[model samples]
Target: MDLDNLIVMANRIGLFFAAQPDRDEAMAGIAEHVKKFWEPRMRSQILAAIGTEAGAGLSEIVAAALTTHRAMLQPA
Candidate 1:
């Protein structure tokens, strides 16, 4: 929705990836992979975070939720 929201979302997603020591590389290495199916706006938000590396802790979860939100917003 906005920058704050985007940051929170990204941070959450980051955390999830960070949690999984095994998958951390796969997750971090393939950051944009998750947003591939997202709408333009969600894609934009995730892209904005691509450079920041701000998605840690709760941010990863938020990002995951944003994906769900994007899916919900998309036309059926």
Candidate 2:
């Protein structure tokens, strides 16, 4: 999978939820969207990108949401 593309997609998702009045809800929405929609492999790929230079492409919200809800987003 293309990590750059995934980061772009996730950043888009974060942009959408960032408008929410509630910060926590926005974060939850981002996590839930990825968890429910992304395949396990996709999820794993994106998760691995966190905190690395490749992950720097991620927006603040995407990075934070991914980091904050990591446990929940992790594929079994």
Candidate 3:
């Protein structure tokens, strides 16, 4: 899948979870959703986006979630 498309999808997931009242809970929801639903390759690509210029398009919430929960999101 395209990186741009993955970024858009991840951001959309973040948007959905952003409605949650608790910030931690929303970030967790975003992480869990991707961990459970996204394939390892997809997960790897998204994780690679963090702190990189290609990921500049990522929404703030999505970028934070990726940065905050990187340990678990990493693909073995």
Best by TM-score: 2
Q: Name the candidate that leads on lDDT.
A: 2
Model 3 poorest ten-residue lDDT run: 46-55
| lDDT computed for candidate 2 | 0.95
lDDT of 3 by residue, 32-66 (tens): 99999999999999898788999899989889998
Model 2 Cα shift for residue 71 (angstroms): 0.5
Candidate achieving higher lDDT, 1 or 2: 2
User: Number of backbone collisions per candidate, in order?
Assistant: 13, 0, 0
lDDT against true structure, model 3: 0.93
lDDT of each: 0.51, 0.95, 0.93
Model 1 lDDT per residue over 1-76, tens place: 6656666655655665666666536353335544554456765655545336543433444444444444443333
Q: In angstroms, how far off is 27's CA in candidate 2?
A: 0.5
Q: What is the Cα-based lDDT of residue 14 in candidate 2?
A: 95
Give the CA lDDT, 0 to 100, for residue 47 in model 2.
97
* Model 1 deviation from the true structure expressed as Cα RMSD, one decimal place: 8.1
What TM-score, over all chains together, does every model reach?
0.45, 0.97, 0.96
| Residue 36 CA displacement from its true place in model 1, Å | 5.4
Q: State the TM-score for model 2.
A: 0.97
